[model samples]
Target: MRRVIIIVLVLLPLAVLAVWIGVRAHRLRPKSAIPAGTSATAPGPQLPSPSSCGAAGRSQLEHYDRSTVYDWLDGGAAPYLDHGFTTSTVATYRFETGGRTLTIEAAAVRFASPRGAAAQAAAETPPGAAPVPGLPGAHSTRDVLVWCRGRDMLRLVSFTPGAETSGPFAALARAWLGGTAP
Candidate 1:
């Protein structure tokens, strides 16, 4: 049983990561930023391409700085990982102080509780899925998921790929809900 335990332990995190990526595929969002404690009443402008939540039809919005992201991060709905790792995001602001220069494409699934959110994320996994921002040969070292919590919160940030590691993604998530980054 020790061998099974060790295998389960080692794969546990990856399983979590897999589920994270999986559910992400189904949770496509719209561009209408919804405010908390209220239901989404309308939609906004849409970005082009895969930016659409291909299926889950989640509401979407994008921000361009860290300051905006911090507002919600401080609101208490921070991101937590499987191994007891949690984040308290301080802020999310611009590095270049200009127009958005990076693009972060994201789709989020929200929850009333952390476990609920995690379970929802896992439960909604997409079939034959891969990384959100990667291509055939590119590989990422960490599991990066862009999410937002709360109602009517916007959750998408886009920019030119060549731009710096802009906080557009963080800002997008913040504009809609609360979350963390990789």
Candidate 2:
């Protein structure tokens, strides 16, 4: 009876450890970025390929320096992630013209759901932000422009000195919605 009791205690702990490890492994596994054939998991709109953001798109816009990618997941993206933002990649450009420099950042964000994205938009809307005319799903708060369609959210920020952020936020939005790069 003594030997049996010791065996039971040891085995019980080993079983518990095994179950804990299994649960952790399942939780840590990576989820597919864009699931296939499922509306719930599908990202709303397809963002342009990074290659599409080359010179052709850059030249069409004013003050655009060059096309490159920004690490949104590491910067300024924590807040959005907290809401419902899932996978995302950002394309950035440096706009230097007329002795002024402005930074342009654009990204297509996939939220957990379309409704979640809309809710996040509403929550993040700044007070007194006006709807952008001719641009659906767009709002402008100071120098920041945020828009959403389906399950995707797009953001454009113009970092120009002073409050005068007359950059290419509109053009970028148009291009993104039109499935092009700018």
lDDT of 2: 0.60
How high is each candidate's TM-score?
0.24, 0.54
> Which candidate leads the pack in lDDT?
2
Tens-digit lDDT string for candidate 2 (105-175): 66567677888778777776667778887887799865778888888777666666345544356656666
Model 1 per-residue lDDT tens digits across residues 54-101: 221223333222223234434423342221222222212222336432
Which structure among the candidates has the greatest TM-score?
2
Regions more than 4 Å wrong, model 2: 1-83, 96-99, 161-167
Worst 10 residues of 2 by lDDT: 61-70
Per-candidate clashes come to: 24, 0
**What lDDT would each prediction earn against the true structure?**
0.35, 0.60
Task: Output candidate 2 Cα RMSD.
Answer: 12.3
